[model samples]
Target: MDVNTRHVLIAGGGYVGMYAAFRLQKSLRKEIRRGEVTITVVEPRSYMTYQPFLPEAAAGNLEPRHVVVPLRRVLPDVQVITGRVVGIDHAEHTARIDPRDGAAYDVHYDELVVALGSVARTLPIPGLAERAIGFKQVEEAIQLRNHVLDRLDVAESTTNEETRRRALSFVFVGGGYAGVEALAELEDMARYACRYYRNFRAEDMRWVLVEAAGRILPEVGEDMGRYTVERLRKRHIDVKLNTMLESCVDGHVELSDGTRLDSDTIVWTAGVKANPVLAESDLPRDDKGRLPTEPDLRVVGAEHVWAAGDCAAVPDLTGPPNAVCSPSAQHAVRQAKVLGDNVARALKGRLLQNYEHKHVGSVASLGLHKGVAQVYGIKLRGWPAWFMHRTYHVSRMPTLNRKVRIVADWTLGLFFPREIVSLGSLQRPREEFERSALPRQFSPPASRSPELESAHAGGRPEQDGK
Candidate 1:
């Protein structure tokens, strides 16, 4: 392999991909400058979302844009392609790229990093796909915020009790950090928004968290989980444990515990599975559909291919003998550093290092000035945990510019009330315009031209024949 002019193609622009490219660009600065190495990153979005702040974004505590790092702006030295990798031919070291509505093309690479992060793992729940929304991206977060506020608007405008109740009811599935934080933050926002509505009170809103498991926040331990449940219960939010959503047909929720709820909004945050693009590739994946990787983050049995983050089943040397790394922002960020260095080492013909980081504790923000955290075996709750959650995540969010912007948002939020204006029209932006431009029968009658009026009357206007 030629040391000069070697191309490194990275799939997915999530935390792992972005960090890996960021590190590689810095580590291989000389090679990049000398035209010895080229780093290319392909992803559907132009920005990398810092998912830790997604809950806050939904709660109006953080700007949606500030929670995402623009890939091109952050990695100017790297080639950032706004496209999706449809297939990966490992044997040929080529990737099939679809530039989103454009013709597909293939790109060759000497080294390939498969960081295609996981997508929301969904089950065949009735009415799930159509009625429920997933809390995964910035768009979803923004949409959910608007949706919650829109529901409040509906409830306030409706006179029917059932309609009002349904509009104010929200059901959230999954008990993990994503589910818990999202529920707590949104509940807080809804409660605050109630102050603006004369008919809607904080108690009028029904926030239900249903987890199939016995407890929530399993990462923070059973103690914290129990405390979180209690705290939520105190806030009048229903915490249903060991509960399965039997069906959510048309937003009418049926639970395994024989309880039925009429909710307009259902947020699904259950879990995630590896990106299915791995199946399309010739890469070796494990039973769970994640790429089986060595401790150095290299794909097992593939010399030039590497994998990391949620899509890779990396052996956990720091834990039990057969344990694999869990999918989390903490692990992904740490793994990217090691993976990036190893890729640089491979290109320069140097010895590679192993990735053996132990699982640090977790922090979860419950709401404004409220949270629970377990860091370095120490447990904290309430204001301390909330402060820690914000501090840790902001420090980790990519780019100093983003960090400052987020902090500024928080600082401003201290003095200002939460913005509850519902921009739900954004979801179907052209609806109003389309409705207005509908057929004449559907639209209101308007003054017509004299010729058009004459034609409509089924007669010609009087004309002189000379």
Candidate 2:
């Protein structure tokens, strides 16, 4: 609260927030030592997830812990607060925060950095929220792995043909990199897992990918996308293009093309929208509900306020006029550094630079050894593309510790097969213990609810009472 000291409060601990804090701390190390400036980062999570490695983690290619960088460890000089920013009054230069375990409080800041990233852009489809899983966080990726492996276990143990069929059927919506990589990696894992089951064969399992768009992996160009579709089809995986998921009620998937299938697993990775926290603040936002920023990442029409990452609509100076940077890690990482340097420059009363980066390319991993990439206009596929995908992500992943761990996982994977163990109970660790503690007579009735009954019976509820 000293008059000479400046408090810089960052609203998120995502890619942009973390990197900006890192840059600011490094750039203003002298000021920080002199007690002239302080940096505080407020976010819900203690760690920043490297989302590109999520699919591989889910498929047991990398450990879950290695995919996340602890903010405190990474930003030792900066104050890391595990909390959510509920409201921000830029006019007053005050931010209201709700700490994870404490009461809400307001903190005044000389400068504000809005870097709260995006959230899953979901729809109002019946049973979608309850049944379908997303592929965003480390937890979701881990849960999907367990759920998929558990489904295979259920199919192997069950004699009912319909039940087995449903358990073996996996449906993924969306054709973006997230959806494609997740589906491909998981399918590969499941296929390898079949070797352990005497009754289950890779052929018996169904992998269905439904995309509302005309093609999948649009970032890799039309030819590569078409090739991806062909490769998937060759593996007997159902690739439905120009298709929409009508409903997923009770795991009964209905497509726009009038096809119905029973699937136990539904992974949704359609799209993402800017974090809704922007609306709570008095910041100027664009039509897409994103904070509008100048070429230099400073908030348009606001003083001492800057924005970047998926939450900010940063103009793409390297692209055509009126164009904006795409919401990808490539842009986010670059934008963060520029945004940080600009903040430091503003503090020192120096000139600011604009954020301008040309579109490099995109890479998508399909299964273990299959991938597609279009880097700097050069196209690649198969093993070369897959190697590029891993190398690119590992290099970008924060910290050398995490990089080494992930590389170690891959190295070990080469010697041993992918582990297909299902640890679904980790999602609800206390469930069995709580149930066991209950007296036999006082136990909940088996017929009380279909969901409870299914849990007790270790089977899914029958459709229409079968």
Candidate 3:
């Protein structure tokens, strides 16, 4: 180990952690070649999931593999640890690394980057955890896709009306970008999938979206939001506004508006809070459990520490005082670039630039050729918004390889019909292995077994031989 060398430790590999590492690795290439600085990224998953494309992936519009950026492939120069940074002790300049296997150990670092990201902000509604699926990662998206298709199968096969009705009913909680896009795309896919079913029609299936707020997708203007609601309603999709999910006990969904329905699928996408592991440290955090960062992406009053993305509350310079950046992918990718540059500047003893970016508006897709967007104060709906949504995300997606692959997927979708098969077994990849690992049960010789059985049954062992 070089005594003069500096180690940069990152706590995640999502938008912020991955892109920040890329920037630092590229900017500090010379320092890294000379072994003067080392960058290590600790993340539970080895790949970074491009969340915006998850809805499409779930709808079979894009391959799931293309939606994730392999951290090792993208950041070859940086040390990628496939584990988690469970604890951070900035006082000693050390972080506790809990690897995928073995015991947790501490790793020393000269600089620390907290880009741990966020987790689903869920409520304590009855049976929520047991029934609801969250659409945060690629696996969850894949699982949800399979689950929905499997529900259709159950509906077609079931003899009882109640059972079939429950199987056909799909409920999505929270009307934010995730819930809305996921529900719409999946519904479109499922509706089209009905072409193969013998007994079910798309109209027979009930798709419901429950939102607690007055409007959904507050990211765009109220008009665009209402228009989105109208589009969904026109599709015969139930869009419940100003309604709360009171309870979902045993698949019975009870709403605040006194509406009740039985649904097998319940997706939770209400919101996300900062990663909870940030609270384990003595580091300063805001009320929302996020690191309060300066305009330069530095953790407030914390030495050699920088934070960004959903995990950090970076002050929004373009907004009024006390306003922090939103936890959107747009902000996160931009923040990572600036944060990485500032980190490099700090290490090289140069002037650090403050991280600042104005909100560039938002875009969301409803279904294929259907969307709503407000970019630069100009509004778009239907196909244009859908195209813009895809264009922006593909351009923002990290690495040229992934960008090309995603585009290729889109090209394929144009020529081929959407895939409707469900691979739910992908969720339990280890099930087959576990079944194989079971101890073998071999029968002893018949005479030997019979002697033991006869003895236990009050007959002599010699009698069995006779």
lDDT of 3 by residue, 255-368 (tens): 999999999999999999999999889899988999999899999999999999999999999999899999999999999999999999999999999887899899999889
lDDT string, candidate 1, 398-443, tens digits: 8889999999999999898888899999999999999888876543
RMSD of each: 5.5, 7.7, 6.5
Q: What TM-scores do the predictions have?
A: 0.93, 0.93, 0.92
For residues 1-466, could you state the per-residue lDDT of candidate 2 as single tens digits?
6898999999999899999999998899999988999999999999999899999999999999999999999888899999999899999999999999979999999999998999999999998998999998999999999999999999999999999999999999999999999999999999999999988799999999999999999989999999999998988889999999989999999999998999999999999999987889899999999999999998999999999999999999888889999999999999999999999999999999999899889999999999999999999999999999999999999889999999999999999977889999999999999999987865676559977677677987677857
Error of 1 at 67 (Å): 0.2
lDDT of 2 at 196: 96
Q: How many angstroms is residue 187 displaced in model 2 relative to the true structure, after the best TM-score fit?
A: 0.3
In order, candidate lDDTs are: 0.94, 0.93, 0.94
lDDT of 1 at 449: 71
Error at 213, model 1, angstroms: 0.8
Give the clash count for each candidate.
0, 0, 0
Show model 3 residue runs off by greater than 4 Å.
Answer: 429-466
Candidate 2 regions off by >4 Å?
A: 441-466
lDDT of 3: 0.94
